[model samples]
Target chain A: QKEVEQDPGPLSVPEGAIVSLNCTYSNSAFQYFMWYRQYSRKGPELLMYTYSSGNKEDGRFTAQVDKSSKYISLFIRDSQPSDSATYLCAMSAVTGGSYIPTFGRGTSLIVHP
Target chain B: DAGITQSPRHKVTETGTPVTLRCHQTENHRYMYWYRQDPGHGLRLIHYSYGVKDTDKGEVSDGYSVSRSKTEDFLLTLESATSSQTSVYFCAISELLAGGFHEQFFGPGTRLTVL
Candidate 1:
């Protein structure tokens, strides 16, 4: 099985709706979880980063990691049209650096007015 | 913003031709990586370097090769490009391993189109 799994969703939501994107993994070895946002024809930008498990909040975004279940999530409060992009989840273990890390297919989010 | 720049920003070449993409960083970061993004595939690592003269292959290193003779420069070469090799390439740098904490900074991608 792929180490990391995420829904490649074209999830459409109305503006001001709360958006949540998630990914699950089978590798308990993964210690670092990251969320990246990529606009069409652009590079992936690091959005939220978390280590191990727990929740981290920054402004309107929150990232949660559950090491026990190997699940991670990113929540966006008050979504905007500018927030429409592909959300990719990446994770790595301390020993897997040379192995190229693991990435999910990325969920496509579109917040419309 | 990443203190990193990717040259050619855009490239188009015929299949079977040799192509080189350059990634230069001003951050002096020790770790450099090359990744490609294809439709439906998040991003796949092609190669990475921990330091100068130190490089290693990633999962998709079949048609690609890389060299890092200098600390701040990492170059990726496709000896004989194929249509399958056409994708957006990204260069990233990290001061150290994430350790489940540190973040890797990414440069604007170079769009490569092989026809």
Candidate 2:
């Protein structure tokens, strides 16, 4: 099994709909969890970041992490068409004196207008 | 785009040719990383540097090499590029925050196609 698992979803949703994207991992040592958004032909940009387990809210975006279940999620409330992009989940631990994140294959989201 | 820039944003080269991609950062972050993105596979780390002249191999370091002679520049070289090496490459810089947490910012990415 891969260290991280995320559905490669072309998840289509109507405008103003709420969107939920999730990823699961097996590493219990992963203390830092992050979400990144990438547009077509562009590099991934940091969207949300959370440490350990808890929820962090930023405007319309919320990031949740569950260390016990090894699950993480990103919730987009009242999504807009401009929110269409690939969402990637990454987690890292301080290994070998460095923190290198392991990424899951991104989920493609399309908020149609 | 946190003061990070990657050169040769697009390139096409024949197999067995040598190629070099450069990542330049102005943020002066102590951590720099190289990653490749491809279909079915997410971003895979190729290499990373913690300080000048300090570099280490990543998961997919085979068939690739890197050099960091200066703090602002980190270069990845494919001594003999292959079709399998063709992919979008990204350079990232990390800013260490309080409590030992770090955030990474990526550059615009370089697309390389080998035929």
Candidate 3:
């Protein structure tokens, strides 16, 4: 499939724990859902942004969208160590007029201290 | 970051020579993008622009080539470089606020190395 399915996680929590990241999609007009945060070499940064489905908080980060199970999530409640890095999941759907973004193959967070 | 700025953050060419990567923006967003981050393929969109001689062609636009005359500039060209076109190159800017909420703001990457 691979319209967008993230799980390239190196996931290794410990700081404050409670970190969960996921993504699953097959199109269906992906209405927009993003969460990016890359650090190693730097570049992707926009942490959490939702439009379709519900759930969106911006403190410890929490963005969840479930457009009828297309699924999308990013929660990192108490994590620390500056919240490691690499966690990307982007989606877009405007077609003709323009709006292109479909990326997923990231999820490598390691907040350990 | 947001205001974007990428230019020879680091480069090391060789493959076939000819490489130009520059994306500068001072906001004035009207949509302008060109991404490429390999290692398993995460961010991939090779060109975009919606004004100033408008442009298009993404999804790994074969070998790459883009140029937006003005509008804060956006140019990515690798006429002959290979080595799978090295990686790390991002430049984004979006604006369509209100309801449609399209927000993309990046640029602090450009680490080419085709040898």
Which one is best on lDDT? 2
lDDT of 3: 0.87
Model 1 misplacement above 4 A = A96-100, B97-100
| Model 1, span B9-89: residue lDDT tens | 999999999999999998788788999988777798899998899998887899999999898899999999999999999
Q: Which is the winner by lDDT between candidate 1 and candidate 2?
A: 2
Which lDDT tens digits does candidate 2 get at residues B1-115?
A: 7899999999999999999999999978889999999998989999999999999999999999999999999999999999999999999998888977788999999999999
DockQ of each: 0.66, 0.83, 0.32
Q: Once model 1 is optimally superposed onto the true structure by TM-score, how far is the C-alpha of residue B40 displaced, in angstroms?
A: 1.0
Screening candidate 3 with a backbone cut-off below 3 angstroms (N, C-alpha, C), the clashing residue pairs are none
Better of 2 and 3 by TM-score: 2
State the lDDT at A91 in candidate 3: 90
In the range A1-113, model 3's lDDT, one tens digit per residue, is 78998988689989998898999998989888999898898888778789889999999989989889999999989899988999999999865587777889798898889
**Which stretches of model 3 miss by more than 4 angstroms?**
A1-13, A17-36, A39-45, A48-59, A62-76, A80-83, A86-109, B1-16, B19-29, B34-50, B54-75, B79-87, B91-93, B99-102, B105-112
Which ranges of candidate 2 are over 4 A from the true structure?
Answer: none
Give the TM-score of chain A, superposed on the true chain A, for all candidates in the order listed.
0.95, 0.97, 0.34
lDDT of 1 by residue, A1-46 (tens): 7889999989999999999899999988887788988889777888
Q: Ten residues in a row with the worst lDDT in model 1 chain B?
A: B94-103
Best by DockQ: 2
